[model samples]
Target chain A: MKKVGIVTGGTTKFTKTDISIESLLVSAIKQIFDNSSNLSQKDVDVVLTSTNANNKYLANITSELSGMAPKIAHSVESLCNSGTNCIVSAYAYISSGLADVALVAGAEKTDSPGLVLDWDKSRGQYKHPIYWSSMFTSAHKRKFGTTLEDLAYVGANNHRNALDTPYAYFEKPFSVEEIMESKPLTENLRLLDCSMPCNGSAAILLASENVIKNFCEQPIWMTGIGQKAISASFTKNDDLTSMKSTILSASDAYKMSKKAAEDIDAAELHDAFSICEIIELEDLGLVPKGEGGSYVRRLYDTKDRKINPRGGLIGTGHPLGATGIAQTIEICQQLQGKAGKRQIDGAKTGLIHNMSAAATSSTVLILES
Target chain B: MNKFEQELRNGNFVCGECSKCNKLVWPPSDLCNNCFNNVKWRPISKIAKLVEFSSKNDEYFCIAEFENQIRVMGKVENILNLHVGQTLTLVKCGFDGKEIFVFGLGD
Candidate 1:
């Protein structure tokens, strides 16, 4: 694959703001230009928007708002992983020689529709994600003897990490005791165990290797990329404890990058739920199967592994469409040594894992400084 | 209502059996997920084993595995000292005018 690099990136605060999706996209786009040295809106060759908002012409609308007239413009939607999907699409456009520079922006409102669990009729009243997440938690506990304390550590650790992240929604760190005693949203999931929905936007400027010379001085190269989709309904999946999509997508990415799990110095995983981060850790090969709880406990005890240095979705707030893009930007900042107080020292390689809809689809990207 | 919901309304638990691979398909699909062949609906045994379960607002919801490797999600009634891998049997189908399958502890 042709080498593509992220020239510049930007993100809005992940909070419950009353900003329209259009304004949010424009803000994120302007931030990218403001951060870059020589990049301009007119230099863009393609513009892609990742959103679930009702706006149909988001691609065109973003261009008009940002004052850009790109050759290609469109929107990409795949639930929470929409942001990563847009980046992957932009990567393709740059690699295929179809475009020299691509701008991928993702924005979502807190009240965006279509997030409800009404697609499956068999679920009836039990269609909500809380039920599915509860099932995963119970199954993991039954299989691995994972306790509630282990899950609480994940929530607390991510929350603490978010204290230093400027764009994080929940900056107040909660102790493990507080997380365990928080209000229960489901059988085993507490209020702190779930990622809150909020309004946010993220933008990334991808440039081909040739364009990087003139556009960016220090670009973060996107080394490997992989994506996969599985069954949307939870019942169709074979194992309730692990997501097959993550496993397969991570494998593809590892093969492309010629790097193993141990080679990655930092990672930004989708922690839509506390258990999700643990399960993704195992499925992505960062930790052995059935050892995710222990791994998280170690991170909590020592603060060594730089997982979710930007506080993950739990601490950063899950803005659905913008989440994957925000995660990618976090990894980029980590690799660039620009992550302020949360920076993981000597971080050269990083990974981003984003998934959607009960882990039915996923995208994995490997980035190197 | 769909065929699966209609079947539940008539007090029958039916699943699509792949005509080619004989794999049981859940969520009532038109084509076999494994072989991409046509599917034929057939009645399945009411007996199932509890795979996993959780409670919310004192109501228990569970995933149960039946014959032909078919797994279904529904509400469980008469929730006693329930545990994973316990035997469960379909007690009734549809609740509150919706196709909500209900199961109970099996003897």
Candidate 2:
């Protein structure tokens, strides 16, 4: 298999304004062309679109709109991690000698049908994401003594980090007190603790090591990738305190990359809710189990941007399909020293964690400069 | 509607049990996940143990496990104190586009 590297990427501002999925996708794609001086319509060999909208032939449509006639074109949808899933598909194409240059684009509308997993009958009347999140919170609180204040700190820190991210949906920062005082969605959840669904798009260009120099000067190599799907049903996650999929996926990712959690200079965690970040920190081996709350609180107090520096899904606004790609882009920028305000200095390695469907499925990627 | 949804709409909670492996296939599949053999539909027990719970607008929602395998999220009623591992009875259940479960403390 050939080495695959991210060549260039672009993103559109995440917002709640009504926008066509195709339009949002094109806006992000146009940035790739604008960013890469050598990139042209004829250079793209594959076009993969990640989205949850019911639109048909989206990859072909976006390919034409972007003036590309790739040999391979299709769509990939895996709920919140669709963007990275599509990128992985492109990586496969490039690594297998099937394609050299692949363009991956992801977009989501505010009212995307992907928000709710209607197929999980186990969720029953409590099908909304908050219910599962609440369950995770409740269990974490019961077992680890995680408190509402700890949950609030996750929100406040992420929102504070988002203040520096231009493309993030949230512009203003919220105090811990403000987040704690927000409208209660459940006994363990608050409105501020949740990630808002919004309209957004992100795109990335990938190239094998052979032709990467043509598209980018300092390409970020995709060193490790791991994905796991235990079950689609929410009830399958018996251990509510931790995300089983995330733990398993991260283990594989670390093993594949030959790097431990300490080597990861920064990471973009899938904080769909506050409890998610706390659990992911432990599950990913970045922190000890049951110590995630204190770790995050310490990060918050010290103004550290080591985790979710670009603002995680909670602060960045979850566009579902576009989120993973946006996260990958942030890591790429951080590694390249292009991330202005939120850049973790001298970061040589980065990680991306994206999950879907109540933590039943997860994808972890390790990237290096 | 499949057997599970059909039975649920009729106020019956049923799960797919494999005849060969005797393993309960959750989410109601046509084939057993363990043996790939055909499954038989049967009613699930109403006695469930609380797994986790949280309240929304004064209405309690929780995950209840039955038969030590099948688990689901539903509404809890007539119980002031909720704790994990507490036994509860499935008082009423129905499927109205979405599955609805009402659990109460056992008398």
Candidate 3:
């Protein structure tokens, strides 16, 4: 397979706004060009957009506004993991010689579907993801003796980490006591345990190895990528405590990259909820099974692990389609030692984990500098 | 209303049974999830075990498992200290005419 590398990335501030998705995409694209003097709109061979907005023809619209007529232009939608899936698609396109330079951008409004709990035909009135997360947390508590305090630590750590993240939505740190005392969205999940839904956009530029030599001085290589869709319905899942999609996808990525969980130096995981960070760590083999809570506590106490140096979705605000792209950008930044205050020392290899819809679908990517 | 919704309105909990592989399908689909064969609707066991439950603002929700590998999500009629593996019986099933399936549980 032809090798693909990330040339540069750009992100919009994560917050609630009335800006149109098109404008967000344009802005993100403009940021990419502004950051890299080597790249221009005319050099882009493909453009892909991912969003859950009601707008149509996003790819064509973005291309037109950005003043590029690329051979491939389309939109991708896979709920929250749409951004990662778009990158995966672009990677495939470049590896298959379909394009030399590809641009992938994701944007989502605060009111995107699946962000809010709504009355659904099949799942009844309790269709919010909190119900599913609550079940997972409760089951984890019963199986592993994970305490409410453990969950609180997860939220507190992410909030504290966000203090240094420039684009994070909530920069102020909340103590563990404050997180535990926050209003309960469910029996086990409190207001602080959940990630806020906001508006945002992020973009990444991918170039083939041949194209990178001409314009890029530093490139983060996309070594391995794995994506899996387990089950759309929560009831169809075999286990509630673990995300099988993450396990399967991460395994595929690790196998392709010829690396184990220990080889990764830093990571950007989809912490849509506090419990998700814990569960994903275990599922990705970063920590042993049923030790996610303990692992998080250790990270919090020692400040050693560079997990979610960008504060993840919980602190950065979850904008659905833009979230996974932002995760990729964070990992890229870390691998390049450009994450500023939150940068992990001596970071060489990194991983990104993003999932959607009750952990039914997942995308895992391994990057190396 | 569709057949599945009609059955639920009649106070019956039914799921699809695969004609080829004999696997049970929940949430009522036209094709079996395992074999992709035409599915036939059949009444499932009224008895189930609570797998997990949560309450918010005095509203209780539960995930219950039944025979033939069917798990249904529903509301608990009586609020109680529920535990995993607790036995529950299906009290009623119906649609609220707004396309939401309401599954009522009993002790």
Candidate 4:
């Protein structure tokens, strides 16, 4: 119950054209300078980092450019929720008076060590439970009518949204038919069904009312955050598609934010597949169950509330660990009224909900400017 | 395999955890959604339901119910046109683990 919250420090520049997970992060810190109007990187106290790539070397990279190294620099591994997790962890530290000025950053270069490296080979965050393979999904496909196209619809739609995002990976638009015709990775899930692998980084600086006044002018407020975990037995689950993680996470986020699902004006959902978003809409309560996909189609057909708005993972890119933080960046951008062309009109409140392990791990955050 | 026996034995079940929300999950953690904390390590259950199923040459798993709220989605367990509620066990589970579950069609 500590008075823990984040300030909207700034948003910097990044583009896949020459995207460096490290550089993006460096630029993000530079933003503290650009928007703070007076603060210097030397004014920061500590640093927190998150990523899901073989590039565990980023810690050295972030500190290199910022000039002054922090007292503590570490990495978090939460698949997609690392950003929010970093923020939450920072909130805990700040609220406790552990650090006055903290910088939270996330970035990943999925372009290296291709994602094909499965869980069994992982050392730190690499060890995965059984059923982490495409074989399991493939097995289901052999028995069901499910096809890769079902997954591609999400990628195509996400990419369509990415067309508007300058930082997105595949900014070019794609059609459902093109995605369907693309290469297959696993059963039902095509290469397109999966999130695009790319390189990018995002960073946010947090300050107490004391330190922040000297550095930030328009600090993006960290309004509410929550996290949860479930037992990790896939077969023991009652429903494969029903996300207990999402509902449970939202349960905490909604309670903390004092808001309902209906109140969220915009969202940045981790759409690893076309269906991921469809199911997420229902899981997040933005849409009714079963009808989620239909609503996606409806929205796409009309080109209205393009969910990813910034072109989702399908369009922008899915740098594993980076996606979650990037999603937060998008949410922060939306709430701060700086999303420009892709901005959700009058977006006073927003959320970034990402899932991992086929909807097992979830993270939800409610943001306000 | 006998009904209860297959439900108890047979093998080949998937397990996972919902790190996002702390829900006891069956299909392991490629994703944990509790406030979207990111996927993490947790105990996953090899247990599940056949709920109500059907037979077909094609594989599929789907179920849409209005029991409590709105529940829909299914799967095709490989080559089997598994009857509704057919208990299944994993012959192979993950990189090094497995368990069993009830598909749940009591016939």
Highest DockQ: give the candidate number.
Answer: 2
User: What is residue A258's positional error in candidate 4, in angstroms?
Assistant: 0.7
Preferred candidate (TM-score higher): 3 or 4: 3
For A1-369, candidate 3 gives per-residue lDDT tens digits of 799999888998888868999999998999889888877788899999999887999999999999999999999998889999999999999999989999999999988975742433335555778888888888888888888889888888888888888888887998899999999888889999999999889999999998986556889999978899976767666787899999999999999999889999999999888989999999999999899999889888987547888888888899888999999998998998898988899999999999988787999999999
Residue-level lDDT of model 3, residues B1-107, one tens digit each, is 55677887777767788899988876578898777999988887888888777777888788888883667677887647777787888776766653233334444
Q: Model 3 residue A209 lDDT?
A: 97
CAPRI quality band, candidate 4: incorrect
lDDT, residue A358, model 2: 94
Poorest lDDT segment (10 consecutive residues) of candidate 2 chain B: B1-10
The local distance difference test score of model 4 is 0.59
TM-score of chain B of each: 0.84, 0.96, 0.81, 0.33
> Worst 10-residue stretch by lDDT in candidate 2 chain A?
A180-189
lDDT of 1 by residue, A97-141 (tens): 999999999999898763654666545557777888898899898
Model 3 steric clash pairs: none
Query: Candidate 3 docking category?
Result: medium
**lDDT for residue A186 in candidate 1, whole number 0-100:** 77
* Candidate 2 local Cα displacement, residue A315, angstroms: 1.5
Point out where model 3 deviates above 4 Å: A116-122, B97-107
TM-score, model 3 to reference: 0.95
- Candidates by DockQ, descending order: 2, 1, 3, 4
Best-matching candidate per TM-score: 2
Per-candidate DockQ vs. reference: 0.55, 0.93, 0.54, 0.06
As a whole number from 0 to 100, the lDDT of residue A8 in candidate 3 is 84
